[model samples]
Target: MVLIDRIRLCLEKLLEVFTVFLLIALTTIVLAAVGFRLLGASLHWYDEVASIGLGWLTFYGANLAAIKRAHMGFPGLVGSAPVALRASLFVISEIIVIGFFVVIAYYGYLVLDILAWDRLVSLPSISLTVTQSAIPISAVLFILCELLSMPGAWAKMRHGIDSEHEAIEEAIRMAEQDLQESRS
Candidate 1:
């Protein structure tokens, strides 16, 4: 379990770093395209390349957001719910997300299959399938991150020890302890 957790953390960190780099690349591509237009030269494929990069950025960014709990959700209602109800809601929500991703992965596979039969006219550098492949890949990774977060969130709700909240509480506790010790 520890090894799996460590591996997941490492993969998450690596993906985060890679997503940052992809964002940088996407920005560079867009800037280059704009510069070419100013010079009366058209970057014929720059837009396509940048679009693919943007797709990758958005997909992996979603995964990173899931890991960080940065994705926007309607947590206000859940937050106000009673303890038992909140736990039940959290578990149900996670299950629903998992099921949704499974369906997404399946549909993504079908789309890839359909795209594989067609040839891209303008951007011949890569196949349509390659571009479409990011869907299933991202969906799978998102599911994995959500699965990992499930246990931690479940444990936290059970004990009311959310790590982010607990960190703040611990900082305050330590500060208070320090003050008491100094006065003594």
Candidate 2:
């Protein structure tokens, strides 16, 4: 359990750093393209590349949100249920989420296969498959985060902890402890 926690923490930190850098690069790319256009110049690759980067950012951000359990969900019904019912509902919900990702990853590969020989319209040098690979990759990353989160949920359920509030507070406390340690 501790090992899984560490792995999840490590992935979260890495994703945070990656997201920051990705955003910086995206901003620079867009601003540079805009500035050049103001000077009667244009970057032909700007549209396609920026669009690709945005897609990647969105997918990666989804995975990050999943790990944090920050996505919008209406769990009011589950919250009012008995402990066993709540656990069962939670597990069923998780299985559904997992199933969704699995389907995405599976069909995403088939889509990639069909586009393997196709190139981007604006960037002939780049393959369509390369840009579209974000779907499957994001699916895999989301699956990993979900898998890591489940055991903790199981533990919390076993301990009769309030899933909505207590786990969130526990996560925040751990983050603060990590932050304090880094500062010290």
lDDT agreement with native, every candidate: 0.82, 0.85
TM-score of 1: 0.82
RMSD of every candidate to native, in Å, equals 4.9, 4.2
Structural similarity to truth (TM-score) of each candidate:
0.82, 0.83
Tens-digit lDDT track for model 1 on 27-99? 9889988999999998888867887898899999999978766576655566667889888888888889889
State which candidate has the highest TM-score: 2
Q: For model 2, how does the per-residue alpha-carbon lDDT over 1-184 read when each residue is reduced to its tens digit?
A: 7899999999989878877887888999999999999999999899989998998888988888888776776555566678888888888989999999999999998899999999988889989999999999889899998898778766765556665676588899999999999999
Which residue segments of model 1 deviate by more than 4 Å?
161-184
Residue 72 lDDT in model 2?
Answer: 73
Please give the lDDT score at residue 122 for candidate 2.
82
